[model samples]
Target: MKIEEVRQHVTTPLTAPAFAPVVPRFTDREYLNIVYRTDADALRAVVPEPLQVEEPLVRFEVMKMGDVSGYGPYTESGQAIEVSFDGERGEYLHAMYLDNFPATASGREVSAYPKTAGSPKLYVDNGVLVGTLDYGTLRVATATMGYKHHALDVREAERQITVPTFMLKTIPGYDGAPRVQELVRTEITDVVVKEAYTAPARLQLFQHVLAPLADLPVLEVVSASHIRTDLTLAPVKPVFDYLKGVRS
Candidate 1:
């Protein structure tokens, strides 16, 4: 897909803050990636299978300059991809990783997918890990989406699942280390039926696939900003402001 074409699909919110220039910027930085993640089961029921999952467990980084913040690419230790599964859950999993490549006088590119005239899409089977790019479009601009699904989709999962919360663990250090990294968790906050679906909706949650983090605290970054994976998790208070706050 063309980079400009995808940008046309979603609109940014007007109220969000603007990007500020980076302090002690990595002026020679290579490229940037913008990543967004939500639960799969809820997403599966809503979006058609093809786009039901917005890429898989790839690393997407957050960007920031000053007061404003947004999405960006990971400097190391991360990749991002779009993925989905059958309506029934049976451990069918898929993942994708993309490298960060900035736009040049010629064009922009993605790490795994090949470059097109401007923007490129995923090459599901046999995607290379290096030196490939797609002509990406549009620099990060401020905006929003309508009827956002920020809240986890719950109510509908009732009867299908019986647990209030569950946890996930990530492979520690990419080695057979004994580290127990945690991911998705579910909490039964409420049960409500969605207007789009007639059946009862359950709200089980998928946790932060990408670490809930900020390179700069109390600040928002722009899309394609670079973040360091080796970097420690940003500090958080008990308040637990998960999305754009200090990590608790």
Candidate 2:
């Protein structure tokens, strides 16, 4: 789809002109407290926009599907990540303190904002990132990398049918504690390689910051069947709504 067509129906601030929704989009949000210390003089140094307790909240929905007329049974897979923010908190904090702080601004309030990650076409050639075909609107594409204890080059990836899906997990038994691990575990299933393009942009987003989380950890990806959507009434307010008011 043309970029403008994709963005026409979207009012989301984070949207670009490239892609648009094929279905009703959804967003989920939650507040996370970041413990820190703020200086009286430091906060005074920066001012902010007038605070508005209410702001429009929106979530984006996207799905891909295909059907074979002669087929007996259908197959598909669906996955959705929480649409959120981190930068909004920073911006909101900057605005409010500068514009709304009391004469003796002494401290800070718990704050949070939207955090989103996208996948762009990417693959590394000669150790340099290079562009490739866009893969089905996916912000990130899962590429078959090293196999069964063997690290393979990007070119040699398709040769291995059995691939791993990487996953970042919270220490399974640990309480709401903070810890994450990346591990490669999975093999491919009955499949079709109709489109193949090496995506290079992934290199930039996968940084040292996410090293503690799942980085190219392998996943056992089978030929997934077409997704079967389960529809239900959405809630009055999703996550981002509450986030808009959080003091950053």
Query: Against the true structure, whose lDDT is highest?
Result: 1
Give the per-residue lDDT of model 2 (tens digit) for 1-248: 58876555433333441222232221110101111223323332322222121211111111222332122112111121111133222112121111112111211111111112322232334544232212234222222221122223423333322222211222333575434222212223334333222221121112234221123221222211111122211211112221243322
lDDT of 1 by residue, 1-248 (tens): 58775564322232331222221122212212333344445335433222234432222321211211222432222223333322322111122222332211011111111111222122112322121222134221111212222332334223222222222223344577634332222222232222211111111112232322221111221222211111111211122122333322
Alpha carbon deviation, residue 178, candidate 1 (Å) = 2.7
Instruction: Please list the C-alpha lDDT of all candidates, in the order they appear.
Output: 0.25, 0.22
Backbone steric clashes in candidate 2, count:
41
What ranges in model 2 sit over 4 Å off?
1-116, 119-157, 166-168, 171-175, 178-184, 195-248
Regions of candidate 1 where Cα sits further than 4 Å from its true position: 1-68, 72-93, 101-168, 171-175, 181-183, 186-248
lDDT (0-100) at residue 90 of candidate 1? 17
